[model samples]
Target: MAALFADPLHDQFGTWPVAYIPYGGADFGEIAAVAAEVGNGDDDAYHAAWIAAAERLEAEAETTLASGHESSARELYLRASVFYATSYHPLFGAPVDRRLLDAYRRQIAAFNRGLALGPHPVRPQRIPFESQAMPAYFMPAAGYETEVRPLIILNNGYDSTSIDMYFLSAVAASRRGYHSLLFEGPGQGEMLYEHGIPLRPDWEAVIGAVVDFALAHPLVDPSRIALSGTSLGGHLAPRAASVERRIAALIADPGTWSIADGFRHAFAAMFKLPPEAVADLGKLDESVMQRAEQAVRADRSMHWKVIQRGYWVHGVDNLRDYLASAELYALAGRAEQIRCPTLITQAENDPAAADAETFFAALRCPKTFMRFQANEGADGHCEMRNRSLFNRRAFDWLDEQFNVEMR
Candidate 1:
């Protein structure tokens, strides 16, 4: 399986173009090597390789952007996005960079262009749900231009940038012929920084707006639209699908029953602070809290602060308030309201979802649960590091649900 999915680029674009020869294949080679080295206990080496590739891609992106070659820049950015995704999480238990602002800025710009050049004729504008406008990048299939093919809206999990949608998952859907839209809403990626729209408990409204937009578009198959969320999105997507009956399918990886718990863990990891301190700090004024989040994202030690602020954005005043949100439990209660087929993917050793089995048991729907071993190499939260494996499983299941015949 590892050999089959060895090259991330292969799974995505199916081989780099010869036009990339100028780079001496450094970027593509580094990516493949890093993927091979990641889980073999050579985490530090993997991290170094991943970072070097990202830096190279970034430089290439700068040149492309400066030349006013939007198309080229977009592709370069797409490659860079994959590199960043690999490096974003430092393995060997190292601290995250406190100041990734510059890298993130470049990433957002690159992804924006990528999305702009790649448009699904049916749904052209990929707008955000919040009042502040942010673009959602989506692609529509060739033949299903008239029918309402089930629209699958993809959301990233905690600490994920929407750019990953382009390099990580969007390509798979494009290949599989699914009308898919990928976006960062609220506490996610650019939406949190560019727009003041923080995370909300009722993600249904966010997805609801997306669904409405898809249905209004000339090409979307409204009735067959589905919601797919990764990482924390696992929680957010299900919450939204429970309320929005129009969504025909709900697919989540690493099921979540509490956003508060998610925040607690993230804050603790990012800031290297105790959960109590993080929770206490969250009670401060909204402006103060936002600054803390920015500070944390900039400073590795303060990373926990970023996680805490994320919780506060979702209406948690403190740890107690967070625990009380009952957002996940309530969403679970409403799962029966979902009128579509559902898919839940869980990691066997994921600490975040220690109670995943229990949570899965509570879900009431036409659902399929897949358990992946931690050693499987694609078992991380939302399987961010393993795009090929994630796509193989997700698209395969989606095809079965849609009754799509294999080509």
Candidate 2:
């Protein structure tokens, strides 16, 4: 095992592996250093190191920007944004913590500044949702700001922020002439940070709202809009697609058919209880619930990455309640409702979900299941370790489906 608290199945150092992706927008050296310090579960140490990195880099960014070196300053500022973002542990009293608030502020300021210097035209805006607005970034393909191109809506995973959608896949989509809109819904990023909204199981409502925004926007091709969900978003996106037919195509990075699989596994492995019992939270013995919650709180790895964050986002204090709420995320009868062409990508080494093949088979729509093995160094969840390779394959599929250009 990588460590006692490593992802029970992936053997990754931590549940999130915040520093695992060395792609753009992050400092590899500093990430490496902070990652090492946190390997043993020193969250305070991790937060401190990353915050220090952000402050130092942001200071440097101001200096270079003053010297008229916008290019150098842009990259530095972006890295600072990433560092500042990494400093805030979502479970660490984030609801009202000034440190988290401050970090979020820096993250946005630096990201917007850096984004303006990018090759594509980007807008940080909000999408109208029910009685409120959802945070998002719209990146029109270079030179196609006013012209309608095929639109790709990107949804980030459980712990990932809205900005992560860009570096993860939006930029790659833009390079291939696709406009990308990256957004955060309940339980993710700013929604959880700014608004007190937690995650809900009916993601179709969240997605339908975005589709409304896309269809109303002048720069979106109503007939060719696709949705790409990363990590936990694999479930969210698919859930949305199950009912939201406006989505022309769908991509589930590391296809996850059910969120219950995670809770089920954790319950069985850690507590030696039947995972299905989680369905009936009210029936669970209070003593059993206490023990399970205690186990989660005791394990530093589970505390922040899974249980604590789950509690905060799901608005539950106990693990049983959290798992009970997750039961709705399953696509039991809904998979057949997805009428759009769908692609489900899987990492050979991922533990995000089991029986993804069954989920793929369940889809009655035009579907493709693509698998990445360990040899390519792309076997981690969402292929984060080598997203370029994964994106190449995914976008190639998109290009063929949409009849777009290739390199």
The candidate maximizing lDDT is 2
TM-score of 2: 0.89
What TM-score against the true fold does each predicted structure earn?
0.67, 0.89
lDDT of 2 by residue, 1-407 (tens): 13323223222422233422444666445556665655555555556766787889989998999998988888887778877876776434435577777788788888888878745535588888886699888888755667889999998888778667777887688777899988889888788877768889899999999998888888898889999989888888999999898899999987888876665666667667775665555456677778777877887667876565777788777666776787767888988889999999889878884657878999999999999887987777787667788888999898887887533
Which ten residues in a row are the worst by lDDT in model 2?
Answer: 1-10
lDDT of 1 by residue, 19-109 (tens): 1222222244554555555534333455455556666776887787788876676666666655544453432011224334445665555
Candidate 1 at 175: error in angstroms?
1.1
> Candidate 1: where is the Cα deviation over 4 Å?
1-55, 58-74, 82-101, 115-130, 142-148, 261-332
Compare the candidates by TM-score and give the number of the best one.
Answer: 2
Model 2 residue 44 distance off true place after TM-score fit, in angstroms: 1.9
lDDT of candidate 1 vs native? 0.59
Error of 2 at 237 (Å): 0.7
